[model samples]
Target: MSSDEIALSPSSLAETLRAGERVRVLDVRNRDESDQWPLGGGDVETTHLPYMKFVQAQAKDEIGDLAAEFDDGERVVVICGRGESSATVAEALREHGLDAVNLEDGMRGWARAYHAEELDADADGATVIQYQRPASGCLAYLVVSGDEAAVIDPLRTFADRYVEDARDRAAELRYALDTHVHADHVSGVREVADRSDAVRVVPEGATDRGLAFDAELVGDSDELTVGDATLEAMHVPGHTTEMTAYRVGKVLIDGDLLFSESVARPDLERGDDGAEEMARQLHRTLHERVLALPDETVVAPGHYGDDADPEEDGTYTATLGELRDRLDALSMEEDAFVDYALSAMPPRPNNFEEIIETNLGRGSVDDDEAFELELGPNNCAATAD
Candidate 1:
């Protein structure tokens, strides 16, 4: 078969999953790797079988018999750490008359797969584009107005996507902004600035954490203009000491401060020894800063949990009023809120320490290394009970 006929792009698989089509996935990675970060989507069935098993079966001339276990008349999408091993297995399955295709570039490609949707909210004559990374539930935004654009919390893997997206809209990428020093993934702010004429902006609080990059440092209530639109910085430190949210008209580009179903884990910035105090700070920020916004203000968070459901428009956003009513942590007293924020947190994101260092400009990594470092679910939020 031709290469195109035997290969599936990650974007194509994402589309199929989003459309609720039934898909059978054959995961050829080891048990630990498969269990730690399983593929996720709607109406999908996944079977985990290490590639070594296929190797052993092929050696005994039982490849056909082995393929029989997965030849249930449906196309199987095979995946591995990278696409190399899976391609061999997929070709073997095809030789046995089963419809099998390799997931191009494997799980790493899936992690790089991104989707952009125009948000259904008022951006004061500006367009708000929500970039969703389904693999990690990381969310970023692009605000465009009058030939000028700014990106908030972009991932390094897709820095070019943001610039290309801005150019396609007839807008110049004016600003690359980071809400905080991220711990889950490498920040694309520096890369975006290097690729375009955009100015790099980071929170002033980040300087305390040894921010080694050259950029404009914004403080509380600072405003930046993107053509006719205004991005007003609101320093709402909690998840991290530098956590900031940008308000573009009625849409709030809130960082890890809040999410659709859960709140940010405060311990990422400060270890457990200082987590309680950070949690207390988080509670105050929620009530005095976030909840203070108008009920109609659309809250666009930095990350979404697996349980988060997108709105009818396919954007992971909610109004301040809706989140206020839904999140129990948002309504609790200070003491209770702090306790809730710290209890039952999921494991910190994989390679988070190194990721944070790289994001802070204290360390450097090549593009491939950066992509590999963040190839897992972004556990940036506290587990909701």
Candidate 2:
């Protein structure tokens, strides 16, 4: 809506990071929103300031505070879930005489362009887990152990490359996708499964994607053994009814529900009433369930966005403690949080209906058709939560 802002391109952010300039990143997304997913990048200096706080404080009022910690003319990058909201804040900061720029493309754009490090599958180097971010914020996991591995949530566009990466790791692609149904991009799960006939496991609750054979419909606490690495599915049904988080060693594959510093959208299933219930469920899971786990767990989320990191043109992985401290909605009173979440709901994915139908065996589209159906920058939510 505002055009007076100077938004930094992903390339510029990368350059700044490489140059080792003194930069401070301001994240404008709410805390609860950031908890489930976070920006991607193995490197980037970031700061978190929810948009409402930025809007209320005004850059002029905050410059003095930052000046106490930073020198004038030092680079400052501002970001939100998407780049739109942060663009407004960046303009305000620039007006206040600071060298601030919005990270163009945001976490979503960066994910498509960067390579992130992976978690160890066994806490031992014997099993290695690697991941790549592509197609906005969708994270593809390559779980390797004993010359065999599998990928999770691989987007259609990266399907071939994902297979190649597995081979490069000297692992046969044996299994994939046993977790949540994606809302933003159509998944390569069914395609990969169909292509290699690898065992693809999904939850029984998935009625949307008409997924085919060698599929195991798992439930809460169900354990999936992948080359000595055990993946335990923890059913966390807030983002979608079928949303499931994977517990692989000390890290959690938090599907859309949790981020490194944010939470994914919870209204993908339609109905404001349903979304309200989901918000409550998410709160319970965050405080009662996830919090109960060991605090040191590394959180690898399903989606990461542009605003997750402003200094780098990419999003990244984060620890559980980082998210619990941010993503504000997760900390609010249940009713109020639900209201906030629903009020900010963005338009659902364009082909969500088709994706659901195809996953549920109700719709039929071939591989090429699926790729066309799946590829795109995610525009569903106005900003990341």
Which 10 consecutive positions of candidate 2 have the poorest summed lDDT? 120-129
Name the TM-score of candidate 1.
0.94
The number of the candidate with the highest lDDT is: 1
Models 1 onward score TM values of 0.94, 0.66
Please list all clashing residue pairs in model 1, or write none if there are none.
none
lDDT per residue as tens, model 2, 161-190: 767777787777777784676666666776
What lDDT score is found at residue 125 in candidate 2?
A: 35
Model 1: C-alpha RMSD to truth? 1.9
lDDT score, residue 197, model 2?
A: 42
Q: How does model 2 fare in lDDT? A: 0.64
lDDT of each: 0.91, 0.64
